[model samples]
Target: MKYFALLFALFFINFKQKTDKLIGRYSYLIEDNNSYIQKDKITFKDSVFVFDNKYMPKGKISYGNAILLENFINTSLVITIPKNQIEKDTIEFYMHDKNSSSANYLDEVTGKGRLIKIK
Candidate 1:
């Protein structure tokens, strides 16, 4: 059917667009009063993303589901970390450019930081 074909095509295009942009590694540096704290890394693949921070408990790795939301020409990423061994936080990164390799990381309690795509 023509309608069925159109629906499938639209779905495929949406899926491809979402996956293509976020399949890489991003790094952010944590600092306090101009002193180096630690570096955090986030690697995204498909619908899941893995987070690594040396300051976390036992230097553990945490994972969560990543959702990319687009508004007009701007895109933002939300990573939902469930209640786990490390911590529970819903981090939202606002893209600074259309390419999305650079973003501003926002935390409700700690304010904001910069995220740069390393890979």
Candidate 2:
């Protein structure tokens, strides 16, 4: 019974990581003093996310890894993206620095934005 429970836990964890992968491009509309209807982009591929701003000042490029958690995706920014965030044309995420030094988030860059993805 003990070994069965351990295996179940392991399987659940592995399944979460495998299914929580972030993929493709998600964009957020940036409302600035200047006129524009369209805006920035966040591209995710192989569990990595990159930011590319087409407008707005100080449009810098940054990237971060989408670390898989048991029930969420962590980006070292304290943002917990549930599996359901992929619905519709937006991926809502919260932002706050965790300042972790773990290997999981070692390559993540610092940035923030509420993205809207076109399906």
Candidate 3:
């Protein structure tokens, strides 16, 4: 029983370390009907994700916490913001590349986007 407990603890720690590789910065461009392009930035660090929009008020930022979930043996990260917080949507990022430098993300409301590691 002791051995089983120790093994489970190690596994959890290892899983966390693997998910930590997603920590980095990413940028994406949003095109509007007016033919204008808007750039957005998102950064993942520790267990928090920060999103910033260039046109937003100075010093304004959106914050969300991330949770790593396992589905049928595959792992994914989901970022969720409290309902009382900013109106921005939640995002789910699935790590694809082995290096964890890039991911495919789906915003809860705005569809999907490619998250390329910039840092």
Cα lDDT tens digits for candidate 1, 1-119: 99999999999998776222344566754446855344577665644455675333222222334333223211333322222312212233322234434454423223234345673
Tell me the deviation in Å of residue 10 in model 2.
25
Ranking of predictions according to TM-score: 2, 1, 3
Global lDDT of each candidate: 0.42, 0.49, 0.41
Off by over 4 Å in 2: 1-19, 29-39, 53-78, 99-113
lDDT of 2: 0.49
Which residue pairs show collisions in model 2? none
Runs in model 3 deviating more than 4 A are: 1-17, 29-38, 54-110
- Model with the higher TM-score, candidate 1 or 3: 1
Q: TM-scores across all candidates?
A: 0.33, 0.40, 0.31
